[model samples]
Target chain A: MTVQKVWSLFDRSQLYECYECSKCSGSCPVTLAGDFLGPRKILLKCLQHGSGRVIRDPLLWYCTTCQVCQDRCPQEINIPELLTGLRNKAAKIGNIPERVKFTVEKIAKTGRSVLGFKVERERKRYNLPPVVEISKEEISKILAETGFFKDLKIDH
Target chain B: MALRYAFFPGCVIPAKYPHFESATRAIAKVLDMELVDLPFSCCPPTSNMKLVHYDSWLALAARNLCVAEEQELDILTTCTGCVSTLKEANYIMRQKPNRRRKINRILEKAGRHYEGTIEVFHLLDVLYDHIGLEAIEEKCIYDLNMKVASHYGCHLFRPSYIMYPEFLSPSHSYVPTSIDEITEVLGGEPVKYMRRFLCCGYPLGANVDEDASYEILREKLYYIKAAHAELIAVACASCFEQFELGQVMIKKKYKETYKLPTLYISQLIGLAMGIDNETLGLKEHIHKIKKLLPRLQERTGRMRATL
Candidate 1:
């Protein structure tokens, strides 16, 4: 099967460990705002529906990545991490908002995510502190050490 | 003494922000942790994740983790965004062996695989666990009285598996005291705040709602102002950008004002180490944390007077 079929085999089981404690919902900053984004419900969606629905739902992005859900979850579920997975799953299903995609593209091309703010120009705003660049040779050496080349199956 | 791993510097710090890397490097060296700049690419490029084509992002992040695991020393990243992405990919890959295997196969083209051999470490954990505060304290030349507001950023504190143990407190203002202690060692007070540990409006970067985003910053500044924070310090580079830039937006939009600057934990530690302003890149800040420079020296003079 293709990658989609393989990913279909996994979902909510990988997402959280809610014992029905409702702390995730209770502690959620967004939930306090009267949204449907309570951690408990998200967990339930992922657990019951797996990535089938949880991944693509806009309710997923409402998460602030606030550790409140994780902190309050008695099960110690990695809520934000799970949120990321679900978000990733949704994105796979074409659930992404347009602006987010553009941000991602910009980051991929230039290694800087936001568009058009040449840092060299604005360094004065929050005057940059002394920065050290990771030299190409250094990155090459890192690739060699991590066996990163072999693991990624790259020629470099 | 030679520790190496794939380094994912992420978008914020590597290009526009450099002090974070410089300071992390300094602390890593003193702690004897050698960081290697890895050949990994961006973690799905933020908003680029296909609401439609998601595997590409997961696969992309997995490719980076696979490279690190292949290297055998674990992957190390400085940006909160990068750390969260790589760690999450490693988690997903580990959970689904077949998925991990598939991604590994893709990485095989790049000569990497997620065999679960490589782990991920945020620079904070690296410093806390490996370097230890005792080692860091030995290097401090001046104690600080800097009253700071600590922003842990959402990515670092959540997913407690990767974060330190102290952050589980529900009512806790500041998440960790180690950074506060670092400021104290340099004579700056790491002032605690009601919402000191809250989000830094960074999650809004990928999302386009600037007004909604401004609310987050404005909300945060409300507490920062109430707490009388001299400077707001951050561990995450994206957060550093949010505060440094967000304040400018806030000043323009709300017609309210905040002149405080954000400091990288590394930048402050560099100061405590007596590394000097120019060496620490103090001049390039948008809000210019230059005023605090004199305070650092004033503390030094105070110490001399006491002596």
Candidate 2:
């Protein structure tokens, strides 16, 4: 499917509200420290081309989901939310970076993301009660209902 | 009854920083608040799930909230990311009826509903807004003379529009000095450093661009070191991961030495309240608080005189 066609999946016309003020880019930590494209530029591309075209852009994964862009935007466009929509489209097509995919899979299977036995021992040693596990069966049911397993191609 | 909360320790802290949990429990006892544990899953972790599966993110966080609501207690989270996800999810589900109805539908499969009857509080917010600094001060058995650089990780108030609705209106002054205020009350100097608002970059470390993540961490450490802050006091588990682990990553990846001890806000407060190092899980830190220990002891001596 063409990238623009996929943009139809999201109702994100607030993206079109960007006035190109460059305020979001200016305050963007990723833009400052790394070669990742700034928020304003990403918005410009999405508005000009479409969110689908930018799906494979590795720079999209660099955003820390920090709300600096939305906070600094003069137009009040929710830049992070828009970026998340774009990332959701990316994930739909299996374009997510490996680490993010791994974490997602971990959550899908274990009902929690992080994997370590030390925490269980530490909970005991510290006299803190063990973290109550969310029923994985219930989590899987929700994932299935949300189409998460099918979207990510993870077999339940 | 004291202001009790269903404690929601996000995935990172239990696996990475159990000390944060221990110390929070320690101080919650001192402050007369209950940190009760309940059945829960990920606040679904906003970093990854929000990008890949927005519905899953909202539904998972909503499920956790449903559990808290079932108990009729407000949710208290130690992780900023959890706070951001749960608080914003509550706001969206309640404010936008359609989204609420849609999410509640999916949640029904898990035997949950997003009624939005419960509230979420970050431990820092609970300490500052509920317990009050004066009450915290009154319980202090040790004075901290150390200088602390408070990193109020981004998720706490950013997109301040959602997390803090009052900031959206012109009438409200949204200066985020809560961490600094807490530090002052504990008798630690809160240092002003550049990039104070920069993320600790731990969230990004989970991505392929982990180097860039560490670069952000290095920049913050540089400023904190330059300011000669004794330690970076953080209220978020993710920030604690970055400084505690990111410092080691920096040494190995870039061959730079930045030994900045990152203390969870509760650990710092527990120390000020004269909870011993052993009880605070101070030894579990990857970046040793060894250098700061004697200085803390000296402060404790000062605390004794005042008492």
Candidate 3:
């Protein structure tokens, strides 16, 4: 996707509403953790350099989507939502992190994020009722129809 | 009347923390809350799946909602993340007609439809609002006299417009008191601590940037420790895991031992309700909670002597 196409996915008015107040960055847990670029800088960078720069930045993945920045924003800018949109765009171009890819693959295959023999064994050991079987065919159908498999290039 | 809900255990609890499920089940039985099981997929956790493909996440979450709607029951989730994803999907499908239409088209492939009829609830909401504090207090067989630092996980109340529309005027999202109040009712003193509203960094720590995740965890642990909290109580499964396992990771990496035990709110409730530790899965925790057992037993002993 081109920078303009990526930029169009977000609300330009809301993006422009940011006044560089930096409260988002100041209150951001990831920013406070010391290496992240934070919301304020990310918004400024995306506006100036376009979504391409922000999408490719490794720091983009560092956001935990905690929404603290959005909650604290005086402008009510939804930074986490914006980051998610960008990540979706990035994912289309196959720019997702390896670990994220693995997780998505697992979900696609198992209809759940984490599943293994040990989990079943633990359930039995605890005397808990067996977990109901998810319809894997339905899950894959949904993923396929939504282009999740296409975007991530997972084998359906 | 007994409240019935389609129990959404989510992915994490059943796979990694069966104890949370067992504890919730035990408490539900005592409270007359009936949790019905259904074939459900992941809530399509917002941290990654939503980030990967928004529509796919919505479709998957909508499928779960559809299953509940078909059964004519609201969803009751043990995990805060599951509640966030499913509730947000329900909210969006209700607010945006076009998005719903598009997602329904996707769901057609899976033979499912989201009617937006059912609501999603976290276990804390049901216990506090539906079950009521007085009922819970009356049911307690033993006093939970320990000092607790209640960790209200972020997903419980963030994005206040969706999670808590009623409190939009003077948002309680930042300073949620339900867990604290619940703690108080159970006879545990909810200690005041800095960084109580902060994220547990499990989302970041579990998936990406382990170092940064540890940094956030360290910050949260420092404040809880400063308050001299006896244990940390959490409603979200992920937060429970983070507090329990994250401390061990912190100790290994930084050589600093906080040794704070973490308990799910359900387990804590079960303890006060006089449920056995084995049934509550207390021994399964990574952090040995043998210290807490003695403290609880001692309190029960004292109460018995007075009687």
The digit string of per-residue lDDT tens for model 2 on B1-307 reads: 7888999988888887777788888888888888788988888878898888888888888888899999999999998889999998888888888768878888887778767788898998899899998999888866688889989999998768667776555632144788899989888899999989867787777776778888888888889899989888988877877788888989998898878788888999888888877778988877788777666533433342111
Ranking by TM-score: 3, 2, 1
Q: Count backbone overlaps in model 3.
A: 0
Q: Kindly list the per-residue Cα lDDT of model 3 for residues A1-156, writing each as its tens digit.
A: 112144444676788898888988898888878767888888898889878777877667887778988888888887877888888888877778889889888888888997767887888877899999988888888878877777777777
Query: What tens-digit string does per-residue lDDT give for candidate 3 at B84-143?
Result: 998899998999898889889888777777787888999999998999999887777777
For residue B236, model 2's alpha carbon misses the true position, in angstroms, by: 1.2
**Candidate 1, A36-125: lDDT as tens digits:** 566788777766776576665676666555666766566656665566556655654666667665555443334335333465554443
Q: For each candidate, what is chain B's TM-score?
A: 0.86, 0.92, 0.94
Check candidate 2 and list the clashing pairs: none
Please report the TM-score between candidate 3 and the true structure.
Answer: 0.95
- Taking the candidates in order, what DockQ does each have? 0.22, 0.62, 0.65
Model 1 misplaced regions, further than 4 Å: A1-26, A29-60, A74-95, A106-156, B2-5, B26-33, B45-54, B69-71, B162-176, B297-307
Using all chains and alpha carbons, the TM-scores for the candidates as numbered come to 0.74, 0.93, 0.95
Worst 10 residues of 1 chain B by lDDT: B298-307
Candidate 2's residue-wise lDDT over A22-58, tens digit each?
9888888887677778888888888888766788887
True interface contacts retained by model 3: 0.74
- Clash pairs for candidate 3: none
Number of the top-ranking candidate, with TM-score as the measure: 3
